[model samples]
Target: MSLHEDAVLVLKAYEGRDEQQRALREVYLEHLAEHPDAMYKPCGAGHVTGSALVIDPEGGRVLLTLHKKLGLWLQMGGHCEPGDATLAGAAMREAVEESGIASGLTLLEGGPVRLDRHPIPAPCNWHLDVQYAALAPAGAVAEISEESLDLRWFAYEEVAAVADTSVVELLEATRARLGA
Candidate 1:
């Protein structure tokens, strides 16, 4: 099946849940199905992507980036490509590329922490975000990318104070996975 078709199948699987979620996924699936090639190319729209919440092994901190476009501290993530075999793999690839972390970085074995959808402004559909969590050794420095204005480690409490409301759930999920 085409990526768009796959997206529709996945979204349909979640019907009768949250209204906002259903609407956002429907919008993305419709747009994507109408423009299948847009998936391979950067739709110039935010488009659906994956993200990673890189947690410190000590369980005290998490790596976050100040997104260049959104101007808010968030986990590393971006547009999915046709090359990705699965959504999880796509999330891992985007995390490594955006954070400049080595491919060898160990990711948690389970699936994503959560799925979120949000509009990316005009002329483009929303992003269907599959967020995952990974553990990195304390003191590991991220190579940082142009995609973000800055990368920093924040304590869990500190993160709660400043991170976007959209990301708090991810942080909580990551922390729970780590048993922090």
Candidate 2:
């Protein structure tokens, strides 16, 4: 199936933990239904983006990239590519690409951990972000990518201070999934 189809199925099957998330899931499903090109970056109406939070459970820390364009310390994720077969694969790919921890990084088994929709610059009004959590292998080291201004590992409690609410929320949901 196409990535668009995969996104539809993923969103349709997603059971949001809160009213806001549930509402966003419906919005995403509708967007995909209306726009066949919703999986790519050129969609003028905005598109579905995939992202994963790289976490090291044993170390009690998460890897965050300082986004070059936004200058915010955020999770490893970006626009979905044409080659992607599933939303979750796109997220995992971005996590590996951005975090530079390519080997042994695995996504949490329960599918996406959260969904975030936010406005972007002109020509693209919104980013419907499907977020997942990627667990880093113990002793994994990260290299800096051109897309980021910096890369750092932040402890569980330090996330709130360095990152925004969205990142904090993703981390919380990730930890909850890990039963931390």
- Per-model lDDT: 0.71, 0.94
Structural RMSD, model 1: 3.7
Model 1 lDDT per residue over 1-180, tens place: 665555556555544235665576576567666766545436655466778888775758888989898889998877777777656667778778777777455677656666677767766656768677877865677888878899888888888787987688888866666676
User: Which one wins on TM-score?
Assistant: 2
Pairs clashing within candidate 2: none
The worst-scoring run of ten residues by lDDT in candidate 1 lies at 8-17
In the range 112-155, model 2's lDDT, one tens digit per residue, is: 99999999999998999999999999999999999999999999
Clashing pairs in 1: none
TM-scores, one per candidate: 0.75, 0.98
State how far residue 139 of model 1 sits from its true place (Å): 3.6
